[model samples]
Target: MPENDVIAAGARTVIRLPRPADQAEFLARVRDSAALHHPWLAPPATPADFRAYLERLTEPQTEGFLVCERESGALAGFVNINAIVRRAFLSGALGYAAFVPYAGRGHMSEGIGLVVRHAFTDLGLHRLEINVQPGNTASIALAKRAGFRLEGFSPDYLFIAGAWRDHERWALTAEMTADGPGAGR
Candidate 1:
């Protein structure tokens, strides 16, 4: 995406919507990172799948972003705000993944920070949540580093890989960050 299309940008990365032009690179990255994503989440793996996934993001309640490296314009990973609820709740759930080439490089951490700011400021969301399977240490760490507090645990929160998986619920309200009500941006 062009800089103008970036929804958010950190020092090392930028977040933008996945476009049709990105299908090849995005799919290649996903294919290379399959080992890294196994048993946790499944991203778009085919052209048809990408088209379907992009179509889903057009819904009013869902937003998806691709975290890209600023220097090389490569796909770092993806972050999505899913199941957004308006009215009284004004919240959304976050889902993210770091591709093999970019894992452990801190790009995702910065991307998430940008996402948090965008969620609170641009999207007018009051809360953002992340659910992680118990064994996914990397995901849990990323959420923690992004300032999402562990709220509780769900015995069978989601179905992943096959059966129902237990997940730890982590959340961050707008008030928890610098952009809290009455605070200066």
Candidate 2:
């Protein structure tokens, strides 16, 4: 957890910045996970899209991390923090997707915990928020597991997949993480 160094390793997963070398493998995983993602997520399944995705994440206001299996160095999933506001209100929005053969294995839960810690301690972010579709129980569960509390709901909060979708807002403050959720457990 150093300046501009995006790596947070855990017992099973390693969360690090996405690289150009990961294009082929990441795209392959995205294609393989089509059904698993579908309406919930539409990651870059094509090489061109992947490049664009990477470019966007590399911007000053965003961060993209890949959760890789520690043993084999295979991609497990991805987490992106977008719209980071660093002045008075240090906050960002969280988005994540798990690839095939790795989904439901709890890698994301662990990676998210690491990311949350990094965002609070290293990045000096005061708050983080996750917006999940109500029908996506898995995403909601992941957020809750990472200590994000239910904040509220917004109807048609975002436009995705050709339609406006309602989303449940879940958030966690750095103070909350330091005091209760991820303090000493």
Candidate 3:
């Protein structure tokens, strides 16, 4: 795949997987957002750790992308389609977050919409799930905007911010894409 052609939603941004050359830039972004993201994302741990994390996500079994500003090429955020399960069920979980500076700009919603289309139409995934803490209104809103239905809540589902938090489960199916819900603009 072309490094620049991974996905685009024509919303002043693009989504594509990170390359090794991006390590220094990506590390800087992670460091800058340490406080805002530590509650959910591991706090970088180390430069090597960040590289390893990115390398793992680039594997065939996982699909991950960085949200970049079209004009400036700034690293705004990231999204991941992980833990793919192919068997009786073809599914994966979606996780995403924008740097504090990029929040509230609607970039995440647009990036997610593009990735969802790729997951269903290009990757042929059947289902996508998102787990968000009860208090994360922004994430919950993004999920809804991307046409994921609130399936239910899972108590103590994940250890976030040093505590186990209840998560609201949201999901979208490939069928929903054909119907226009998960279709990108």
Candidate 4:
């Protein structure tokens, strides 16, 4: 497959794994949206960190992708599937964030839907989970829109923004959705 392909929805946006060449663009977006993302995705992200981040995405144990606007070809957001476990339980964690410019346009939701499909069908994962901070209403809505059910709140689940923040766990199982794994394909 090409480095990135545009996913068709009411609004066209490209979704695919980020290549090494995209590092500069990714860094620029992070810098530009520092204020909006700092609370959740703080600074101190050096070039090395970004390089390692991209490398992790290509690793067999994890996968990640960037969302871009088709018309402008700008880096709008990112999504990741991490902590893949293939033992008794084939499961992984889902994480995503969109730039301020792309927020509330439903682009992240569309990208997430495509990634969820690929995760279930292509990756053969049985379950996916997302943890969102209690205050992140946009992210919470994205999870719901993508069919993740709210499981419960996790106290001091993650240390973000210099403190341990509470997160609400949301999950989606392949068997729970009609279009999930082993449905027909």
Runs of candidate 4 with Cα error greater than 4 angstroms are: 1-11, 181-185
TM-score of each: 0.97, 0.92, 0.86, 0.87
Q: Cα miss at 112, model 4 (Å)?
A: 0.5
Report residue 44 deviation for candidate 3 (angstroms).
3.4
In angstroms, give how far residue 120 of model 2 lies from its true place.
0.6
- Please provide, for model 4 over 61-99, each residue's C-alpha lDDT reduced to its tens digit, 9 standing for 90 to 100: 798877777667777788889899997788999888887
lDDT of 1: 0.93
Q: Of the candidates numbered 2 and 4, which has the greater TM-score value?
A: 2
Ranking by lDDT: 1, 2, 3, 4
After TM-score superposition, the amount by which residue 181's alpha carbon in candidate 2 deviates from its true location, in angstroms, is 13
TM-score of 1: 0.97
**lDDT score for residue 154 of model 3:** 98
- The better-scoring model by lDDT among 2 and 3 is 2
lDDT of 1 at 71: 85
The sequence of per-residue lDDT tens digits that candidate 1 reaches over residues 1-185 is 46688888788999998898999999999999999999899888999999998999999999999999988889999999999999999999999999979999999999999988999999999999999998999999999999999999999899876789999999999999998777785
| Residue-level error in angstroms, candidate 3, position 2 | 8.1
In the range 43-76, model 2's lDDT, one tens digit per residue, is 8878889889988987878988999888788999
lDDT, model 3, position 139: 84
Q: Which candidate should be chosen as best, given TM-score against the real structure?
A: 1
Q: Which candidate achieves the best lDDT against the true structure?
A: 1
The superposed Cα distance between candidate 2 and the true structure at residue 11, in angstroms, equals 0.6
